[model samples]
Target: MARNDVDLLDLSLDELLTTTRTVRKRLDLTRPVPRALITECLEIAVQAPNGSNQQRWNWHVVDEPDLRAEVAEVYRSGMSGHQADPNRATRDIDYSTEEQQRIASSVAYLRDHLHKVPALLIPTVGGRMDEADIFLQASVWGSILPAVWNFMLALRARGLGSAWTTIHLHKEAEMAELLGIDAAKHTQVGLFPIAYTVGTEFGAGARQDLADLIRWNGAG
Candidate 1:
Protein backbone atom coordinates (compact mmCIF):
# COMPACT_ATOMS: atom_id res chain seq x y z
CA MET A 1 0.00 0.00 0.00
CA ALA A 2 1.14 3.58 -0.67
CA ARG A 3 0.19 4.64 2.90
CA ASN A 4 -0.39 8.28 1.96
CA ASP A 5 -4.05 8.68 2.75
CA VAL A 6 -3.59 11.09 5.67
CA ASP A 7 -1.05 13.77 6.42
CA LEU A 8 0.46 14.07 9.84
CA LEU A 9 -0.15 17.47 11.38
CA ASP A 10 2.89 19.54 12.21
CA LEU A 11 2.81 19.76 15.97
CA SER A 12 5.63 20.37 18.41
CA LEU A 13 6.14 17.80 21.13
CA ASP A 14 4.63 20.07 23.78
CA GLU A 15 1.64 20.93 21.63
CA LEU A 16 0.99 17.30 20.87
CA LEU A 17 1.40 16.40 24.50
CA THR A 18 -0.95 19.00 25.90
CA THR A 19 -3.68 19.16 23.26
CA THR A 20 -4.60 15.47 22.86
CA ARG A 21 -7.88 15.71 24.69
CA THR A 22 -10.16 12.77 25.47
CA VAL A 23 -12.42 13.39 22.50
CA ARG A 24 -16.05 12.34 22.79
CA LYS A 25 -18.45 14.94 21.45
CA ARG A 26 -15.97 16.26 18.91
CA LEU A 27 -15.30 12.97 17.15
CA ASP A 28 -16.28 12.97 13.47
CA LEU A 29 -18.42 9.87 13.66
CA THR A 30 -19.49 10.07 10.02
CA ARG A 31 -15.97 9.93 8.56
CA PRO A 32 -14.10 6.72 7.88
CA VAL A 33 -10.66 5.99 9.32
CA PRO A 34 -8.46 4.00 6.99
CA ARG A 35 -6.87 0.83 8.33
CA ALA A 36 -3.54 1.94 6.90
CA LEU A 37 -3.62 5.07 9.03
CA ILE A 38 -4.34 3.00 12.13
CA THR A 39 -1.46 0.73 11.18
CA GLU A 40 0.77 3.76 10.69
CA CYS A 41 -0.04 4.92 14.19
CA LEU A 42 0.59 1.46 15.59
CA GLU A 43 3.98 1.36 13.93
CA ILE A 44 4.91 4.49 15.84
CA ALA A 45 3.13 3.32 18.98
CA VAL A 46 4.86 -0.03 19.44
CA GLN A 47 8.14 1.85 19.81
CA ALA A 48 7.06 3.00 23.24
CA PRO A 49 8.94 1.76 26.33
CA ASN A 50 7.88 -1.56 27.80
CA GLY A 51 9.02 -4.09 30.34
CA SER A 52 11.95 -6.16 29.05
CA ASN A 53 10.88 -5.21 25.53
CA GLN A 54 8.72 -8.33 25.43
CA GLN A 55 6.17 -6.50 23.26
CA ARG A 56 3.34 -8.87 24.04
CA TRP A 57 0.61 -6.44 23.07
CA ASN A 58 -2.09 -6.97 20.48
CA TRP A 59 -4.06 -4.20 18.79
CA HIS A 60 -7.57 -5.18 17.71
CA VAL A 61 -9.03 -2.58 15.40
CA VAL A 62 -12.74 -3.02 14.70
CA ASP A 63 -13.86 -1.13 11.61
CA GLU A 64 -16.53 -3.46 10.32
CA PRO A 65 -19.87 -1.78 10.83
CA ASP A 66 -21.66 -4.86 12.14
CA LEU A 67 -18.89 -5.68 14.60
CA ARG A 68 -18.60 -2.09 15.70
CA ALA A 69 -22.33 -2.04 16.31
CA GLU A 70 -22.12 -5.20 18.39
CA VAL A 71 -19.27 -3.80 20.45
CA ALA A 72 -21.21 -0.59 20.97
CA GLU A 73 -24.18 -2.60 22.20
CA VAL A 74 -21.98 -4.36 24.74
CA TYR A 75 -20.63 -0.99 25.83
CA ARG A 76 -24.16 0.32 26.16
CA SER A 77 -25.21 -2.70 28.15
CA GLY A 78 -22.32 -2.09 30.50
CA MET A 79 -23.48 1.47 31.02
CA SER A 80 -27.21 0.78 31.18
CA GLY A 81 -27.23 0.33 34.94
CA HIS A 82 -25.36 3.55 35.50
CA GLN A 83 -26.84 5.85 32.87
CA ALA A 84 -29.16 7.46 35.37
CA ASP A 85 -26.14 8.88 37.18
CA PRO A 86 -23.41 9.19 34.59
CA ASN A 87 -21.24 11.35 36.79
CA ARG A 88 -21.21 8.92 39.69
CA ALA A 89 -17.59 8.04 39.09
CA THR A 90 -16.46 11.66 39.27
CA ARG A 91 -18.19 12.60 42.46
CA ASP A 92 -14.98 12.59 44.46
CA ILE A 93 -12.78 14.29 41.89
CA ASP A 94 -11.47 17.77 42.55
CA TYR A 95 -12.97 19.30 39.40
CA SER A 96 -15.44 22.17 39.82
CA THR A 97 -19.18 21.70 39.30
CA GLU A 98 -19.05 23.21 35.80
CA GLU A 99 -16.17 21.01 34.74
CA GLN A 100 -17.90 17.98 36.16
CA GLN A 101 -21.10 18.77 34.31
CA ARG A 102 -19.18 19.22 31.08
CA ILE A 103 -17.57 15.84 31.56
CA ALA A 104 -20.89 14.20 32.29
CA SER A 105 -22.50 15.68 29.20
CA SER A 106 -19.66 14.52 26.96
CA VAL A 107 -19.70 11.06 28.49
CA ALA A 108 -23.43 10.77 27.94
CA TYR A 109 -23.02 11.83 24.34
CA LEU A 110 -20.36 9.20 23.73
CA ARG A 111 -22.52 6.53 25.30
CA ASP A 112 -25.34 7.40 22.97
CA HIS A 113 -23.29 7.76 19.81
CA LEU A 114 -20.46 5.25 20.18
CA HIS A 115 -21.94 3.02 17.49
CA LYS A 116 -21.61 5.83 14.99
CA VAL A 117 -17.85 6.19 15.46
CA PRO A 118 -15.82 4.87 12.56
CA ALA A 119 -13.62 2.41 14.42
CA LEU A 120 -13.10 0.85 17.80
CA LEU A 121 -9.74 -0.26 19.15
CA ILE A 122 -9.30 -2.69 21.98
CA PRO A 123 -5.66 -3.29 22.90
CA THR A 124 -4.76 -6.35 24.88
CA VAL A 125 -1.80 -7.75 26.71
CA GLY A 126 -0.49 -11.34 26.97
CA GLY A 127 -1.53 -12.32 30.50
CA ARG A 128 -4.50 -12.46 32.80
CA MET A 129 -3.78 -10.26 35.83
CA ASP A 130 -6.92 -10.53 37.89
CA GLU A 131 -5.26 -12.66 40.56
CA ALA A 132 -1.68 -11.60 40.09
CA ASP A 133 0.40 -9.87 42.72
CA ILE A 134 0.98 -6.17 42.50
CA PHE A 135 4.43 -6.69 40.99
CA LEU A 136 3.16 -8.97 38.21
CA GLN A 137 0.14 -6.77 37.58
CA ALA A 138 2.35 -3.72 37.31
CA SER A 139 4.72 -5.45 34.92
CA VAL A 140 1.90 -6.68 32.69
CA TRP A 141 0.05 -3.36 32.50
CA GLY A 142 3.24 -1.29 32.37
CA SER A 143 4.15 -3.06 29.16
CA ILE A 144 1.01 -2.07 27.26
CA LEU A 145 -0.18 1.30 28.59
CA PRO A 146 2.69 3.34 27.17
CA ALA A 147 2.17 1.84 23.74
CA VAL A 148 -1.55 2.63 23.98
CA TRP A 149 -0.79 6.19 24.99
CA ASN A 150 1.66 6.43 22.14
CA PHE A 151 -1.07 5.22 19.77
CA MET A 152 -3.36 7.99 21.08
CA LEU A 153 -0.64 10.58 20.53
CA ALA A 154 -0.05 9.34 17.04
CA LEU A 155 -3.79 9.54 16.36
CA ARG A 156 -3.80 13.15 17.53
CA ALA A 157 -0.89 13.98 15.22
CA ARG A 158 -2.88 12.69 12.27
CA GLY A 159 -6.05 14.71 13.07
CA LEU A 160 -7.87 11.70 14.58
CA GLY A 161 -9.02 11.64 18.18
CA SER A 162 -9.98 9.01 20.78
CA ALA A 163 -10.74 8.59 24.44
CA TRP A 164 -9.53 5.76 26.67
CA THR A 165 -12.68 4.07 27.94
CA THR A 166 -13.18 0.98 30.14
CA ILE A 167 -16.92 0.98 30.56
CA HIS A 168 -17.16 -2.02 28.29
CA LEU A 169 -14.79 -4.00 30.45
CA HIS A 170 -17.57 -4.41 32.95
CA LYS A 171 -18.87 -6.98 30.50
CA GLU A 172 -15.43 -8.16 29.46
CA ALA A 173 -16.42 -11.80 29.18
CA GLU A 174 -19.33 -11.00 26.89
CA MET A 175 -17.09 -8.76 24.81
CA ALA A 176 -14.49 -11.47 24.64
CA GLU A 177 -17.01 -13.90 23.23
CA LEU A 178 -18.32 -11.36 20.77
CA LEU A 179 -14.80 -10.65 19.52
CA GLY A 180 -13.38 -14.16 19.99
CA ILE A 181 -10.72 -12.82 22.34
CA ASP A 182 -9.15 -15.57 24.40
CA ALA A 183 -9.90 -14.15 27.79
CA ALA A 184 -7.96 -16.87 29.49
CA LYS A 185 -4.78 -15.66 27.89
CA HIS A 186 -5.18 -11.95 27.24
CA THR A 187 -6.26 -8.92 29.26
CA GLN A 188 -7.95 -6.03 27.56
CA VAL A 189 -6.62 -2.57 28.37
CA GLY A 190 -9.48 -0.35 27.25
CA LEU A 191 -11.76 0.60 24.37
CA PHE A 192 -10.93 3.52 22.08
CA PRO A 193 -13.14 5.16 19.44
CA ILE A 194 -11.09 6.31 16.44
CA ALA A 195 -12.16 8.97 13.97
CA TYR A 196 -11.13 12.37 12.66
CA THR A 197 -12.00 15.29 14.87
CA VAL A 198 -14.92 17.55 13.96
CA GLY A 199 -12.35 20.33 14.20
CA THR A 200 -8.62 20.26 14.74
CA GLU A 201 -8.50 23.00 17.32
CA PHE A 202 -8.19 22.11 21.01
CA GLY A 203 -6.56 23.65 24.06
CA ALA A 204 -4.98 22.33 27.22
CA GLY A 205 -7.38 21.12 29.87
CA ALA A 206 -7.61 22.59 33.36
CA ARG A 207 -5.87 20.81 36.19
CA GLN A 208 -5.00 21.30 39.82
CA ASP A 209 -1.87 23.24 40.74
CA LEU A 210 1.16 20.94 40.50
CA ALA A 211 2.55 22.30 43.74
CA ASP A 212 -0.34 20.75 45.62
CA LEU A 213 0.23 17.32 44.07
CA ILE A 214 3.99 17.18 43.54
CA ARG A 215 6.65 16.29 46.09
CA TRP A 216 10.25 17.47 46.30
CA ASN A 217 12.43 14.54 47.44
CA GLY A 218 10.37 12.48 49.86
CA ALA A 219 6.84 12.30 51.21
CA GLY A 220 6.36 15.60 53.01
Candidate 2:
Protein backbone atom coordinates (compact mmCIF):
# COMPACT_ATOMS: atom_id res chain seq x y z
CA MET A 1 0.00 0.00 0.00
CA ALA A 2 1.16 3.53 -0.74
CA ARG A 3 2.11 5.65 2.29
CA ASN A 4 -0.21 8.50 1.44
CA ASP A 5 -3.23 6.23 1.17
CA VAL A 6 -2.69 4.78 4.65
CA ASP A 7 -5.29 5.96 7.16
CA LEU A 8 -4.30 6.28 10.79
CA LEU A 9 -7.91 6.24 12.01
CA ASP A 10 -8.46 2.82 10.48
CA LEU A 11 -6.62 1.13 13.34
CA SER A 12 -8.92 -0.22 16.04
CA LEU A 13 -8.14 0.63 19.66
CA ASP A 14 -7.30 -2.97 20.51
CA GLU A 15 -5.18 -3.35 17.41
CA LEU A 16 -3.25 -0.21 18.29
CA LEU A 17 -2.73 -1.28 21.88
CA THR A 18 -1.75 -4.87 21.14
CA THR A 19 0.32 -4.35 18.02
CA THR A 20 2.45 -1.68 19.64
CA ARG A 21 4.37 -4.26 21.61
CA THR A 22 8.11 -3.85 22.16
CA VAL A 23 8.95 -5.27 18.76
CA ARG A 24 12.29 -7.01 19.13
CA LYS A 25 12.44 -10.35 17.33
CA ARG A 26 9.63 -9.38 15.01
CA LEU A 27 11.53 -6.28 13.79
CA ASP A 28 12.16 -6.69 10.09
CA LEU A 29 15.90 -6.27 10.46
CA THR A 30 16.45 -6.96 6.78
CA ARG A 31 14.17 -4.15 5.62
CA PRO A 32 15.04 -0.47 5.84
CA VAL A 33 12.95 2.14 7.63
CA PRO A 34 12.68 5.30 5.58
CA ARG A 35 13.71 8.65 7.02
CA ALA A 36 10.51 10.35 5.93
CA LEU A 37 8.40 7.97 8.00
CA ILE A 38 10.51 8.53 11.09
CA THR A 39 10.15 12.27 10.71
CA GLU A 40 6.41 11.92 10.12
CA CYS A 41 6.07 10.02 13.38
CA LEU A 42 8.10 12.64 15.21
CA GLU A 43 5.86 15.38 13.86
CA ILE A 44 2.92 13.59 15.46
CA ALA A 45 4.90 12.90 18.63
CA VAL A 46 5.78 16.52 19.37
CA GLN A 47 2.07 17.30 19.55
CA ALA A 48 2.08 15.52 22.89
CA PRO A 49 2.08 18.05 25.74
CA ASN A 50 5.08 18.73 27.90
CA GLY A 51 5.39 20.37 31.31
CA SER A 52 4.50 24.10 31.07
CA ASN A 53 4.63 23.96 27.27
CA GLN A 54 8.40 23.58 27.24
CA GLN A 55 9.04 21.72 24.02
CA ARG A 56 12.64 20.90 24.87
CA TRP A 57 12.65 17.42 23.47
CA ASN A 58 15.03 16.42 20.68
CA TRP A 59 15.32 13.16 18.71
CA HIS A 60 18.47 11.74 17.14
CA VAL A 61 18.10 9.06 14.51
CA VAL A 62 21.05 6.79 13.69
CA ASP A 63 21.15 4.90 10.41
CA GLU A 64 24.82 4.63 9.53
CA PRO A 65 26.48 1.25 9.98
CA ASP A 66 29.56 2.55 11.84
CA LEU A 67 27.50 4.65 14.20
CA ARG A 68 25.03 1.84 14.83
CA ALA A 69 27.88 -0.47 15.81
CA GLU A 70 29.23 2.09 18.25
CA VAL A 71 25.84 2.53 19.86
CA ALA A 72 25.39 -1.25 20.02
CA GLU A 73 28.71 -1.68 21.77
CA VAL A 74 27.78 0.84 24.37
CA TYR A 75 24.42 -0.90 24.82
CA ARG A 76 26.09 -4.30 25.25
CA SER A 77 28.42 -3.00 27.91
CA GLY A 78 25.45 -1.72 29.86
CA MET A 79 23.17 -4.72 29.30
CA SER A 80 25.39 -6.98 31.39
CA GLY A 81 24.91 -4.90 34.49
CA HIS A 82 21.25 -4.19 33.83
CA GLN A 83 20.46 -7.87 33.28
CA ALA A 84 22.34 -8.78 36.42
CA ASP A 85 20.35 -6.44 38.60
CA PRO A 86 17.62 -8.40 40.33
CA ASN A 87 15.29 -5.44 40.43
CA ARG A 88 15.57 -4.91 36.69
CA ALA A 89 15.37 -8.57 35.68
CA THR A 90 12.32 -9.15 37.84
CA ARG A 91 10.37 -6.34 36.22
CA ASP A 92 9.97 -8.12 32.86
CA ILE A 93 6.63 -9.86 32.38
CA ASP A 94 6.77 -13.66 32.32
CA TYR A 95 6.06 -15.19 28.92
CA SER A 96 4.71 -18.55 27.82
CA THR A 97 7.14 -21.18 26.52
CA GLU A 98 6.84 -20.21 22.86
CA GLU A 99 6.73 -16.51 23.65
CA GLN A 100 9.71 -16.79 25.93
CA GLN A 101 11.80 -18.46 23.26
CA ARG A 102 10.78 -15.88 20.72
CA ILE A 103 11.65 -12.99 23.01
CA ALA A 104 14.93 -14.62 23.98
CA SER A 105 15.90 -15.07 20.35
CA SER A 106 15.10 -11.46 19.61
CA VAL A 107 17.02 -10.23 22.64
CA ALA A 108 19.98 -12.34 21.59
CA TYR A 109 19.82 -10.88 18.11
CA LEU A 110 19.72 -7.37 19.52
CA ARG A 111 22.61 -8.10 21.81
CA ASP A 112 24.64 -9.29 18.86
CA HIS A 113 23.59 -6.91 16.07
CA LEU A 114 21.59 -4.01 17.45
CA HIS A 115 23.74 -1.76 15.32
CA LYS A 116 22.33 -3.45 12.23
CA VAL A 117 18.75 -2.37 12.88
CA PRO A 118 17.75 0.06 10.14
CA ALA A 119 17.01 2.97 12.49
CA LEU A 120 17.95 3.90 16.03
CA LEU A 121 16.07 6.65 17.84
CA ILE A 122 17.56 8.41 20.81
CA PRO A 123 15.08 10.68 22.58
CA THR A 124 16.53 13.53 24.59
CA VAL A 125 15.40 16.20 27.01
CA GLY A 126 16.89 19.70 26.95
CA GLY A 127 17.71 20.22 30.61
CA ARG A 128 19.23 18.24 33.41
CA MET A 129 17.98 17.81 36.96
CA ASP A 130 19.74 17.11 40.23
CA GLU A 131 19.21 13.45 41.07
CA ALA A 132 18.88 14.28 44.77
CA ASP A 133 15.76 16.38 44.17
CA ILE A 134 13.05 13.74 43.79
CA PHE A 135 10.30 16.01 42.54
CA LEU A 136 12.53 17.73 40.03
CA GLN A 137 13.77 14.39 38.74
CA ALA A 138 10.23 13.08 38.35
CA SER A 139 9.18 16.21 36.50
CA VAL A 140 12.05 15.90 34.04
CA TRP A 141 11.06 12.34 33.10
CA GLY A 142 7.38 13.28 33.14
CA SER A 143 8.02 15.82 30.42
CA ILE A 144 9.52 13.40 27.88
CA LEU A 145 7.86 10.02 28.48
CA PRO A 146 4.45 10.99 27.08
CA ALA A 147 5.90 12.19 23.82
CA VAL A 148 8.08 9.07 23.55
CA TRP A 149 5.10 6.76 23.96
CA ASN A 150 3.15 8.79 21.44
CA PHE A 151 6.00 8.42 18.99
CA MET A 152 5.82 4.64 19.42
CA LEU A 153 2.07 4.68 18.89
CA ALA A 154 2.50 6.68 15.74
CA LEU A 155 5.00 4.12 14.45
CA ARG A 156 2.56 1.28 15.14
CA ALA A 157 -0.12 3.02 13.14
CA ARG A 158 2.32 3.32 10.27
CA GLY A 159 3.10 -0.43 10.19
CA LEU A 160 6.33 0.01 12.14
CA GLY A 161 7.26 -1.18 15.65
CA SER A 162 9.77 -0.18 18.32
CA ALA A 163 10.96 -1.35 21.69
CA TRP A 164 11.95 0.92 24.55
CA THR A 165 15.39 -0.14 25.74
CA THR A 166 17.91 1.76 27.86
CA ILE A 167 20.61 -0.83 28.33
CA HIS A 168 23.14 1.38 26.56
CA LEU A 169 22.63 4.31 28.88
CA HIS A 170 24.60 2.34 31.46
CA LYS A 171 27.55 4.10 29.84
CA GLU A 172 25.65 7.26 29.13
CA ALA A 173 28.83 9.23 28.86
CA GLU A 174 30.32 6.93 26.23
CA MET A 175 27.10 6.85 24.28
CA ALA A 176 26.85 10.63 24.44
CA GLU A 177 30.38 10.98 23.11
CA LEU A 178 29.76 8.43 20.38
CA LEU A 179 26.60 10.23 19.29
CA GLY A 180 28.00 13.73 19.98
CA ILE A 181 25.28 14.22 22.58
CA ASP A 182 25.80 16.53 25.55
CA ALA A 183 24.80 14.47 28.53
CA ALA A 184 25.27 17.30 31.00
CA LYS A 185 22.94 19.61 29.12
CA HIS A 186 20.58 17.09 27.52
CA THR A 187 19.44 13.79 28.97
CA GLN A 188 19.16 10.84 26.56
CA VAL A 189 16.00 9.39 27.99
CA GLY A 190 15.67 6.16 26.00
CA LEU A 191 16.89 4.25 22.95
CA PHE A 192 14.58 2.42 20.55
CA PRO A 193 15.01 0.33 17.42
CA ILE A 194 12.46 1.39 14.82
CA ALA A 195 11.57 -0.90 11.96
CA TYR A 196 8.63 -2.60 10.27
CA THR A 197 7.34 -5.68 12.04
CA VAL A 198 7.69 -9.02 10.27
CA GLY A 199 3.96 -9.64 10.66
CA THR A 200 1.13 -7.10 10.55
CA GLU A 201 -1.02 -8.74 13.21
CA PHE A 202 -0.50 -8.16 16.94
CA GLY A 203 -2.82 -9.15 19.78
CA ALA A 204 -3.60 -7.31 23.00
CA GLY A 205 -1.34 -7.88 25.98
CA ALA A 206 -2.44 -9.10 29.42
CA ARG A 207 -2.99 -6.64 32.23
CA GLN A 208 -4.79 -6.33 35.53
CA ASP A 209 -8.20 -4.67 35.81
CA LEU A 210 -8.29 -0.90 36.20
CA ALA A 211 -10.33 -1.16 39.40
CA ASP A 212 -7.64 -3.35 40.95
CA LEU A 213 -4.97 -0.80 40.14
CA ILE A 214 -6.85 2.38 41.09
CA ARG A 215 -7.37 3.48 44.68
CA TRP A 216 -10.67 4.91 45.97
CA ASN A 217 -10.99 8.51 47.13
CA GLY A 218 -10.78 7.45 50.80
CA ALA A 219 -8.42 4.50 50.42
CA GLY A 220 -10.43 1.29 50.59
**Which candidate wins on lDDT?**
1
The residue-by-residue lDDT of candidate 2 on 79-171, one tens digit each, is 887878789854666765787778778787878868878999999998877463888888788889999999999888888888998878778
Off by over 4 Å in 1: 1-5, 82-96
Encode model 1's per-residue lDDT on 1-220: one tens digit a residue.
1266567777899999999999999999888888888899899899999999999999888999999999999999877755556576844676567878799889889999999999999999999988899999999989999999999999999899999999888789999999999999999999999999998988998899998999999998
Q: What is the lDDT of candidate 2?
A: 0.84
**Stretch of 10 with least lDDT, candidate 2:** 1-10
Question: What TM-score do all the candidates reach, one by one?
Answer: 0.92, 0.86
Name the candidate that leads on TM-score: 1
